[model samples]
Target chain A: MSTSTSTSLTAPTASRVAGTAVLLGLTLAPFLLGPYAVATLSRILVFALLALSVNLLTGLTGLPTLGQSAYFGVGAYTAAVVAKNLTDIGPLQLLIAAGVSALVAVPTGWLAVRARGVVFLMLTLAIGEIVYSAAVNWKPVTGGTDGISGVPPVVPLPGTPALELDGLVYFYVLAVFLLLLGAVTRLGSTPFVLALRGIRDNEPRMKAIGYPTRRYALTVYCGAAALAGAAGSLWVSVQRFVSPGDAGFEIAALALLAVVIGGTGSMWGACAAAALIWLTRDYLGNLEAVAGRGPLLLGLLFVIAVYTLPRGLAGVRLPHQPSRKRTA
Target chain B: MAGWLDGNLVSVVDGIAFGLLLFTIAVGLSLVFGMMDVLNLAHGTLYLAGAYTAYALSDGTVPGLLLALAAGALVGALGGAALTLLTQPLARRGHLDQAVLTLGITFIVADLLAAAFGGEVLPTDPPASLRGTVDLLGHTYPVYRLVFIAVAAALALLVHLVFERSSLGALVRATVADRDMVRAQGVDIRKVLYGVFAFGAALAAVGGVLGAPILGPGPGVDESVLVLSLVVVVVGGLGSVRGALAGALLIGQVQTLGVALLPQYAPFLLFGTMLLVLVVRPHGLVPSAVRT
Candidate 1:
């Protein structure tokens, strides 16, 4: 519809400028914001990564997934268990987490990618619920929903001091997030992504053109799961606690909502929407005027966003393609 | 093994009751999913609303239970109509949009119910007359569940007859074939869509009302039921009443008996079962349409 068209109309220069400014804000956040605000920002960055993962499949590849949180949970628990027994190095934990998540994604994503549209959604959702149930019932490994905690603080590097301050931890999360974000952005111009968009627009046509659409879908599915798993690792570093709720339906739904509100396929849009949602949940919901009404406000936000921002906030940005098309 | 079967017969029978309850909820979801392609995530909210209705109305009497069922049906119908109205326009965009919109509705309604009923999971008791146990093959089982199995069996038969053999099935097929032609006949299409909603939502709500004693009304029941029913719908295949029945009964056994037998690996068992069924028959056990 209008969404796909408006998505193509975003001014690249304007997007770069906004992206730079946002990066600056994130880089300087520790010095500017309070400890609590910094912690929230850190969480937002992790959630934004999750939103990016959803953007990869749901937004980019046209496979509606409600199963990314399962990988997220897996990454977190893997990291927790790694920190407990394997290694306390943050990067190592992240690698192991992402690896584990991608491994889990193999069979689950295999089953999921067989169907498209709502059936795909159903399969992924059941996958998420299954993972969530496993997290709760697998007492020996997952800690039986209480999750793993009281681990040694993650050392960002091999020889560095273990991070204890929230500000310092925020920097570590920011670094990995930036790395992944850069990689995904670099992936945008590749022909593989072009194939993904093709699949999204019309799978039958893509298949008729001799493109292996299913493989494309499955590849993106694993990549997205890895990205979500990395986010989960960051989440562990930020909160130092993990729980079954991390892999629950709500997280998957919110991540998918972030992708939708961000304008499907718009990376920065998904990240921005994720931040906005988290702020609404953490700040606006807890504000004295609307305390304990977070879910209500979130619900209202969802309804309004779907109706008012059909093309999403990204689509609204620099909408006038005629004047903004000037090259640098 | 004989001793084990003898000991666990209650759990097996319990699975049937639980499965029937799942059928009531999943049948509506499956039909709407197959026909409309609308991702009604708030379908569980309707069930929650019905369970809450049961909790509010049940005075430990049969009349109260009946009243709760009727009221639950009304509440569910209204919710369904509202959801249909909210989501209808978004369907053209994509299922993702519908998913977001319906999820929003779910969040708003679930929070409202939570605020009204408190955050705790409230236990809803069966009517006084149905409270006692009944003897079955030298084993005692809840009278309400035994009655529920009978009622649900009858209900399932009725749904089968109504959708499969009745003229309504022809009308549905006709409408799906040509919308404008049906509209030309002076049937308000919105009302028909609303009727679809009412049928599906009413069934789910009634399931909630009757199932309140078994599943209870709680903060997270909506989500669990939603997931469970989604499992049933997928396992049974969409738009087929028989599919929903088969899937629900199978899942009911997996859930109850699996828990009773291997408490630790119950979730894996559910996954394994789903994976096995899907691997064998990707369209589910009884897909209504052999779609490409």
Candidate 2:
């Protein structure tokens, strides 16, 4: 809703140039950075995709869900299973993962979209926990807590060599990330997204205006699930291992947090915030001085961010969009 | 048939105890959410803090248990007051913001608790006098569990009577219904809010102190307890004590009996029951007459 006010009809030339510069930097980063850094960047991109999926529901559709991890886990497990039993074609794995995730989302999203606000949040939380429990209990399929390991390297194309090298994997992840990112950007201008925003702002009004609000909500929910699942599949390709922990509450919470910290409704903001959060937990946590204090520091970050960054990182400043109006 | 009854009797009793414990915890959460429109995600942290208090202060004596209860209640009250301060500013921002803020608090408090108590599940014992077993339905059950059932049942009854029967309860209800009108009549509505928040939090902490022996203190215990309480609150109707009791008892039975009967499908059973209930009663089983 606030985004609609700032992003008026005319395209802001400055922001476009800035966005291009950022994309150029990202494209060249793998070559400039070390293998470890490239791998981290690749992981960040995967998490960013997951965060973007969360933004679709929370930011765009006004559905605050803590269940994206369910689809993410589903995608990861599906990919792992596919890699172990079938061919390791990356695109094929991603497609299956997204399809299965979307299929699973239909019923769950139907139930979830029926409720509004806190009730909806509770339902999603329950669904997430249930999925996590399934991951832990379905030992034969998910390998229980140990998860499915020894996943074969991903082949970008059917005839191509497997991408075993970290840099090559990063490239594969980057390519998929960019494709999905562009697709999502294109989707933002569609009538469907406008309908979703209308639903978010006022469901009753949208319904009165002849919009099938629930159908739109469910559609976005499934789309978001598919995106999260795609991210999960990419996660398996990058890590070469899938565990129950990958689909746990922490992942769901962090993804939601990243979306909030990035400023709701801004896709690029969500991606950047996801990277910051991932680095805070993964890179900063591994530092010798802060070793084992990751959760403490992360908790502090959450507190400070919620208090300080009310509108999130995206709300900071872009020549195009003005700062959010402070209501209180 | 006699053998089957005997086999299920223990689980049935365990279900009652578990259900009562849930009632103690969830009633507070239900009341706070219903009355104040604040989704306190850190409610479980109060329970965790109370359990930790029991672990720290219990000396295996009756007095020790009482002390733990008092301390737990005090800690909960203080924590509740602090939460009130934190959430009051964001009252106008909507429940989502409140949820996020409280979730942050949950994270901070849980991390602090883990730092202090370590990550291991600390199993606590009941007071020495209540340690032994008692014969029930031709089977032996722990004396502490039976005592817990009795105490929790009494507590539930007290809460029901206080909230449903007393003038103070009337005042609280009136405040929830029309805070501006209540304030217009010279009632210090802020005090009422603070009192409700503190009392509800205290109840959760007391539940934690009593339930520590059953659930134990652990790293992820806060999360599990939070989920269970949320389920109970949702199933029982958000603001009503009777609803909380009914929801907790049903979930308790489903948890204990379902696990005992169908160990492999226990997880699905919990969510299945929730799904079934939500489908039938979208507003919960016994929605409050006064809608928020």
Candidate 3:
């Protein structure tokens, strides 16, 4: 609360510097680290993508949604279904997953865009649960909770070698992550995204000024869903399996929490927070001594973040941002 | 003719009973959100605490349940007061801060609970006095459910009378309508906020304790309760008691009837009903006039 004001006004340069440094460092991490570390980094990247997708809605558009799992599931299923039957072209799978997710978001976002604020949050949570149940129940296609396992490793390019279960797939995943992260960053900087920020700040004024607020909102929502779908596909590629739990409420909730903790409008902050959450949940959570207390630790981190670093990991503080303003 | 009439009667009674249970849990959410404009995501945690209390206190005896009720209410009130006090500093910061802050609290409490309770569903049984079943139209129904209905209905009546009839209720409503005006009238709005929050939390815990036999306590009961309460609050329209009752009954029947009739699609049916309701009445079935 204390630091929110000045950071918002001065965050552009600071965030850019931090973003580039983190991206470069992450891209170089796998090469320097061992196989186990590479695998962990791959998971972190997937989570980063998921958290960034959440930021697209919550931080950029002020939607505060808890439904990224819907898109994430779509991506995972797309990759799994394609890997099971069609080609294991990772790029193609990503595209199909994104497309399918965006398609589903059309009507879902239409219904969701009707409400704003807490109601919007509730609707998204319901939608996520419904989609998750469908995946759990729709047996033939979704594999009915068993999930589509035995997904083949993505076939490498014609000249290159295939990425078998070895550490080779890590590089491929890294490339895909970099490309998607770049695109998301570009998307966030676009005028269309600027319009979304405007909607987040003041919808009525935007509409009064003749901006087609609903259309813009729906578009952004679908786009973010597509990003989440891409992340899911990437998840499948790395894990080679998809489960109902992959699209469960915890993922959606964590992604939202990451965005909130990472400074809402800061993409780099989201990715950083995602990594933090992933490390906490996956690495620290699995420690033998701590046992099953990962959630407790993460919860403590959240409380600390709220109290100490209101701007989240990227630290994009707002300058005299008015409190008690109308929010959804 | 007798069989047809009997079946319909059974469904109606069952629906009302389920609705009453929902009302007991959801009214707390409605009052807290409506009156204080505080979106307490941890509302479900209080219910979870209450359910756990019931689990801890019950020895399959009536006196045990009475003790659980007292403990649940006390813990809930304390929890609510703590939440209000902790959040007062950021109350002026807006809903985003409040949301994040409460979410943090929810996560912390959920983890602590999971640790304490071993991450497994804990079954809780009603007292011996409320156990067993009674015959209804050639079908047997749990007697505890019937008791739940009676007790919940009475609680509802008490709540309605307190809010709609009592002068204290008038003051609370006055604060909700215009905080500055109530303060101008020499009423301490802060005290009212704390009291309402604590009281609402106590009510949620009480519902959790009473309904534990049916809903049960588990690792993720907090999330489920939170989601259900959200649905109830939304469908009932943010802060109105009548709205909360109507929404809870509608959802309660939807849950039981949908699961009974269409087991495969029960979850979807619940969501579908919610989607339909939202589409038809975006503000909810009963919107609060003062709050939004």
What is the per-residue lDDT of model 1 for residues B27-78, given as tens digits with 9 covering 90 to 100? 8888777666676778888889999999999999999999999999999888
Each model's lDDT: 0.85, 0.88, 0.84
RMSD of each: 4.6, 3.4, 3.7
Clashing pairs in 2: none
Q: What tens-digit string does per-residue lDDT give for candidate 2 at A166-252?
A: 999998999999999999999987899999888877788999999999899999999999999999999999999999899988899
- DockQ order of candidates, best first? 3, 1, 2
Model 2, span B1-292: residue lDDT tens: 9888788999989999999999999999998988888888899999999999999999999999999999999999999999999899877666666666888788778888888899899999999999999999788999999999999999999999999899999998887778889999998888988899999999999999999999998888888888889999988888888889889998999999889999878878887777767766777877543221
Candidate 3 regions exceeding 4 Å error are A1-20, A156-159, A316-327, B1-5, B8-12, B287-292
Clashing residue pairs, backbone N/CA/C < 3 A, model 1: none
Better of 1 and 3 by TM-score: 3
lDDT of 3: 0.84
* Runs with alpha carbons beyond 4 Å of true place in candidate 2: A1-11, A318-328, B1-3, B288-292
Q: Which ten residues in a row are the worst by lDDT in model 1 chain B?
A: B283-292
The CAPRI class of candidate 2 is acceptable
Scored by DockQ, the top model is 3
Candidate 3 on B1-292: residue-level lDDT in tens? 8766576666667778878877888888888888888888888899999999999999999999999999999999999999988888766655666777887788889888887887789999999988999987687888998888989999999988888899998888787788888999898888999999999899999988998998888878888888888888888788888888888888887887656767778869777777778777888887543222
The CA lDDT at A279 in model 2 is: 91
Query: Highest lDDT, which number?
Result: 2
